[model samples]
Target chain A: MYSFTKPKKKQFFKEDTKLWLVFYAISVFLYVSFALFLLVKAYFYSKNNQIYNQNIITLNTKISSLTLQKENIKLQKTIYEDIMVKNSLIKDSIKNLLDLIPDPITLNKFLLKKDSLIIYGITPTKDVYNLLMLPPLESIFTKTDTTFYQMPNGWYKFKSINKLKGNNETAFN
Target chain B: MKLPSIKIKLPKLKIYGIDVIKNALFFAFYISMTLFIIAFIIAPSVKIFKNAKNSYFLSKQEFDNTKQNYRHILEQLTKLQNQNQQILNAFKRNFNENNFKLFAKDYMNIIKITKQKTIPYKNQFAKTSYIITAQIKSPKNFYDFINNIKNYKNIIRVYFPIDFEKSNKEINLTFKIETYRLLTAKAEEKAH
Candidate 1:
């Protein structure tokens, strides 16, 4: 019955509380800084969006004004072309009238009015009158009146009054 | 080296229930604070960052579109200016007064060449209208005269009538032609 008792060892909990606390503080700080950075980025993006919206508005206004000007120019060009076309028609009509005159006959006095023509001319013979009253000339006039006088100089003097027909309805407004 | 020393031992300290609860409550508060940061602050901040990135891209795209539209409009304006210049040039070429006079001289020469006698007549001029009057001999010569006048590029209107004299083969033809001429800058301003 000889029993020997051993000395008791000290009991202690092994924990690095200071290191843990420091780590947690650093983590929270990092989260907060990252959140603040995100907020700043959001603000910057919103500002950029506002600037871009303003630019778009300015551009739209400019585009609209320019479009209006372009349309105005195009309208002016159309009017010019219409005037040229009408002038060309009138010139062609005058040319056709000139071509309708018979050869070998001399013209003394020719008068053109608003919608009619008056001609006083001498022909060597009366047969030239038939030529003047022919198809092309007939088609151009709605009415024609002719009077012939025998001259002492062995020539026939004739006076012709002609009224021009209206142009086709579809040709112009 | 001598006899064994006897040591007196102290009693172990007991942890009370309230102290344990206090420690547990502290740990829970720390954990809850971390959770609160993660759930409220950090999570929402991440969402804000994502939204900001998306907005930045959208804004950039819109800016690019606006820039392109602006460039296109500028190009169109340049094209319009060129067209305006062309219209002005064409107007100058077709409506010059000196050119109209030259055309009239050429027309008179053509009448003479066609064996027609031309009566001297005065020309009437206005802001936008010109009239030249002449007399010729034969109907054929008048026809030729009209045809030759048609070759002139600037004539706008022509009116001619021939009357034949009973005494001879000669005819008196009166030609009234209309044309345009470019106005002076001052005149143009006045007209407008």
Candidate 2:
């Protein structure tokens, strides 16, 4: 492009040649300055691209890990919930058994030993004691074993064995 | 007559390949400068803007895929939750039955055996799987109790303890037990 600006200058002292020389100097300076700017910009742009790619890779990794964590948590919840249900069943079983204890069998002292019960108490009369000693009642009490202690004060210290399913009145006998 | 003895002084300049090379280098420097200014500074900025638009489109596509995956996971989680609810309801119904009292009685008998042997039941589990442990103070009593337990119709096991100490009247024995009923029930249900 500069070839179009060539001049017919046989004499360096001529006014026209001097004018062209001045223009050439200015153009050289402008070109050199522009080249330097490009070099600096290109270096920085390449660096920016490298960093951008790295960030995308890091984000992709994090997303995958989070997905795995979510799946593990869901599985854990199911297992934990099943355990809670079994525990509730055990609790309800205890409540139902407590409700079955009969009235009038005033329980004075009760001890739970192994699968049996030992009681120390007074029944109003011996007939009531005899009635309670029957097999249906005794079977309930002796499902494990029941023993009673007779005190001199007419108050008896009684011990009896009870299966959790037995009649509650057997405790009085 | 006036031109006699006149000598014109000329500018003296040296000729070397170095000067030609310098001139060629300067010219090339100028041309490359113009091309690079347009290519690096101006052209790339345009490309950068275009790439920004491309990035936005790519991110949008990725976001859509992630959202779809999230929706699928949510659906699976909801189904699991519903199944869990049904299982819990069934368990509750079973627990509230009249026979629960009998089950407690049986369970208490086992506890009594444990206490008679002076073994404490551990309430905590070791791993994600189920674990059971038993300790007996008297080996003779434990032997007898084990015989009785074997006669009973419940499924159970007694593992030998790794460490046991025997002092005087009691011989301590430790064992482990596990159940497949609660542990693998869900997987079996799914299989069916």
Candidate 3:
């Protein structure tokens, strides 16, 4: 008891106490609201993650499928170009063979097979066919056989067969 | 042993209608509530946020990588098709005898083109063989015809059993040609 102060009753909830209570309420509200905000953000993040995962799987599958298709097209192109090259080689080979014929010995009828060539033509003499046509045929083929028949006009009709052994050489291209 | 006791008096505040004694209890209640919420709700919420963030980052990385891979494959496929445009078109082209004859009219005279049979090739293509017999003035026509096959609409291949017989003045050429083309489907949609 103070001599100069008036007698007063003590109040449990003073102005300062109420103010402190309000502060505490505000602090708790802020803490709880922040937690709730974090929870909502977490939920959205999880949802977005799930969507991204699905997209990733779909994209990977598509990528793999496209890769396979690319390989297939490459294979097709390889085969197609290979055929074209082979066709060109065959053409060149036939052209070279036709250009091998000499003028003096006429190639009346010729048979060009896959592995062999049969030439039937007329020559003034057997010696002319042997000297002009037989040497080149022997050079190009693995084997050559020529049969000459004496014609009524004193000329010779010759049949020559040239074959490629094992069909391994590029002779027929 | 017995210890001597000392009496000590602590001041107590007295109020009329306010229970000042219970203030300590309320203060403790506020502190306890705060602790409880922090332990039960806020902690778990923070944990959920952290876990979800981590998962999202991982998935995002994977998604980005997959997207890049898809783009790369698509680019490669388009480039491959563009590089082999002629080959692709030739594979898909159908064989037309009349059109081919007209195209070959400059090279040689096509006597006949009889389609022999159809067979499967490479599991995705069909190969049809044809017996072609024609007359040419010289072997140069045959050479030009074969050379021009590369530029033809359909892919053609010359097979074996090719014969060249001299007929009177003109030369007779008999040969087999195979045309290769795509099967039915499975390459159109994804390629585009």
Candidate 4:
């Protein structure tokens, strides 16, 4: 009797197994190194952030102090200027009154109190006394009262009280 | 004649111990080279770069803050200067001695217009006030003089005392006039 036999095929192992192992080892090494590097970088970043925060705080304080100083300076300057302006106005008012006095009048006593003016002097004639009641003088005072007496020496003694008006009243008030 | 074919058999190959050790040593060398590059070169370089970046940002922020502060100070300075200028202008528009003298001269002119003769006797200046005494020919001339001076500017108040002497056909009048000026530095010093 003849017997039939089947043919057997040869088996082969995968190629480059050693090379793959080396590649895996190198990859693991690189990964660990990168992770450590990241950790170190994070630490440095945190330290730097803290330093910067401190610097900013210091700068802010300095700026606030400077602002306060500026405000103080402004206030002082304003006060000084106000005083000077008021003084000037008062001086001008005085000059205005002095300009209005007419010649040929002799003043014996002159007194200024608040918004009132008092004058005591001698007038040669009644006409000179009448002239005191007109125009520029009239405009300067709100009210005026005059008292005159004829002396034995033929001279007239006069006293006048005038109330200051307008600018003078407002300025003193 | 047909000859019988003979089958040939090959010898089996075997792995040696030295070859295994050699492969292991090669793998170790490769790992060491990778470690050296990562620890000594790449890692340190990365750390240095990170440090440089952090410092750059910090300095940049500081610069910006300083610039802002500088601008704020400059603005304050400008405001102060403007206020000072305004004060100066106000001072210029106000009181001066020259103006006072001019006002007095104008008053004398008004007296001349009234056809009166006045002889100025004494002029006394005080810190805050001025007093002028004059002798007039007649009471009428004195009254006209008073009327003219009433509207003078800058007179906070005025004081005049009238005294008269009788001469034949003529009345002689003497008057004292007081006026004020703005307070000055010299006046303040004297007060102190």
Candidate 5:
């Protein structure tokens, strides 16, 4: 049922049409691939951002607490230094009080309290204690009383009680 | 390999000795398709991609700065702790009565140490005291004891009601020794 012509293969599409379609498909593929790559990169970046934000919050909390701890250390140092200074003052007061005793009086015992001091001593005469020891005690204490007992020997035994009222005790001094 | 050759037959009719109408229609189609693809797909995608890149860089820089700040704070904290290491350690130590007696052995003879009531001090510390009766040869011993306390292992405050009584040749020294310890809620929990 054919004429005397060479038989040709069936053509589904023209050559130029196929070429144009391939070009368009490549362009679309390249665009889609690039867009997808960018989206994946953006997703990763956002994830990293969230992680870093969380880390920042935790670090900030730690930093604040560390600062508080530093302040606390400073407070401890202040307390320590104050206590040391108070201790030195106590020592100085005790030294000064001990140095107050004169040669005429022989101290038997002395009770040093926060607000009061009581001294028991032997004096060569009542006048010796009254002249030397009584004046200093009277100067330091708010109230002072002296009781005398004559010893077997003419030497007098005197008990002096010194009292400090209110907060004017001047501490141990 | 030999490729198959294909062809499409077009209308033979022409005007003005050329296929100007068909060529113009083809050119118009290509131009419109190019403009449509660029505007609707590629341009929008590119813009979004650029914005994402910018955001990523911004977040990265912010993270770097925050990390630097954290490191700086950490370093400062370490330095402070190191500088006050002795005082901080002393606050944490518990007062040992036997150790204290041994420490005071050089200064005086400790006859007795009676424990007193414990009280809270400064909200974060516990103050416990002992009424101590000791014997010393002279006032110099008491002076030395007070001075050397600065080098002791525990933090202590010598309080009031100190008495010095001369009994025979020896002097009886009675005083209150206050020892402070860190008693924070965290430390209390650790104790339990």
Candidate 6:
């Protein structure tokens, strides 16, 4: 009679264990390197984020200040321009009103200093002289004290001072 | 001579529970590591790319919006200044009270075919413009009033065919008229 038993597989897989260990080491190394890369990236990203936030804050402040400055400059420019325009308008109005004053006055030796105007000339006729000395006409031309000196040959020189007021509202023919 | 031999046999070994558990744990660890690579590393990089693209687009949009508004404000300011200048120039010619009175009287005389009614005068814009409201006796009076306004010097526009009430004496017609005066030459030139 012969005895019988089940047979076992040989240790052929043990020879490939080193290969599996190398594969496991490679996988672990790859995983660790990737993790480090991510860590570095995250650190840089966070640092950049902080810098960006700071920059945004600073830029926002600058923008606000710049906007305020621009508005102030605009307002100042408008105010200065308005003042210039008003001054020019007043000067032109004075010139035009003065022109409306009778041409017969024949402004000669005219000197304007401060608030006074000194005029020296001779009136062509006595009648024209009297008209200039009248109340309403005289009042328009001379809003202040006036002095006149009569010389030879029916000639007279006058010195007058006028206080400027609201531009001439009188109608001129 | 003859020789006889017997065949050899070996016993089977049973697998241990510790060895099975060890294999299962190794498999689980490898699967978890693979999942981590895909989830933590690959996904975040993709998200960063998308965000960068979006931020660039938004920045350009903001710049364009601000630039357009700046131009519009400048245009409005210029237009206002021009209109002001035009008004100043028109006043330089003559818009005195006497001229207004003369022009009004002439207009009334031309439309004498229709009955006229007195209107209260209203002044505006530092007395530069005057408004008057009156009533006409008939529709024909309204027509004549319009024509007269067109010929008037200081009178600019007239509102006629206004709401009215029917009366025994005449048809009550209410209308408004406007008159403008030019600024003095000195004021006009200065404004320019």
| The candidate that achieves the highest DockQ relative to the unseen native structure | 3
Model 6 per-residue lDDT tens digits across residues A45-112: 55555555555555556556556545433543443344334333433433453453465665443333
Candidate numbers, best TM-score first, in rank order? 3, 5, 1, 4, 6, 2
DockQ of each: 0.29, 0.03, 0.52, 0.07, 0.40, 0.02
Query: For candidate 5, lDDT tens digit of each residue in A1-173?
Result: 97899888878965655666687678668767876776777777677777877877887787788778878888998999999998998888777777888998888777767788788888999888889888888888889999999999999988898888776556474
Model 2, docking class: incorrect
What value does the lDDT take at residue B104 in candidate 2?
Answer: 29
* Per-residue lDDT of model 3, residues B1-192, tens digit only: 889999865345558755565566567877988899899989999999999999999999989988887888899999999998988888887899999899888977899999999999988898999999888888888888888888898899987767787788788888899999888532663377
Poorly placed runs, candidate 5 (over 4 Å)? A1-3, A6-14, A100-173, B1-55, B184-192
Model 6 alpha-carbon drift over 4 Å, by segment? A1-20, A40-98, A113-121, A124-143, A152-156, A165-173, B1-22, B31-192
Please give the lDDT score for candidate 5: 0.82
True-vs-predicted CA distance for residue B49, candidate 2, Å: 8.2
Q: For model 3, give the interface RMSD.
A: 2.6
Q: Fnat of candidate 6, please?
A: 0.01
Off by over 4 Å in 1: A1-21, A104-127, A130-134, A144-173, B1-35, B42-56, B80-84, B89-192
Can you tell me the DockQ of model 2? 0.03
Report the Cα lDDT for residue A110, model 2.
Answer: 37
Query: lDDT per residue, candidate 5, B3-26, as tens digits?
Result: 998887666555776565555555
lDDT of 2 by residue, B1-192 (tens): 577887865444337523444455446765776577666665665566556556655655665666666666666666765755544333222112123224323322222122122121122112221122233443334444433333332222332221223325433323333221222334455787
Over B1-192, each residue of candidate 1 has an lDDT whose tens digit, in order, gives 899999966444338523454345447867898899989998898898788778778877987887787788778877876876544333334455456556555333222212132221122122243344333344444444445543455434443332223225444333444443334433665787
lDDT of each: 0.58, 0.43, 0.85, 0.53, 0.82, 0.46
Please say which candidate is ahead in TM-score: 2 or 4: 4
For candidate 6, write residues B1-192 as lDDT tens digits: 657777654333337523444455556866887788768875675466445445544544444454454455445555544544433333334445455445544333222222233333222121222334333454445454444543344324342222333446454433333333322344656878
TM-score of the A-chain for all models? 0.64, 0.38, 0.70, 0.57, 0.67, 0.51
* Fnat (0 to 1) per candidate: 0.50, 0.00, 0.82, 0.07, 0.60, 0.01
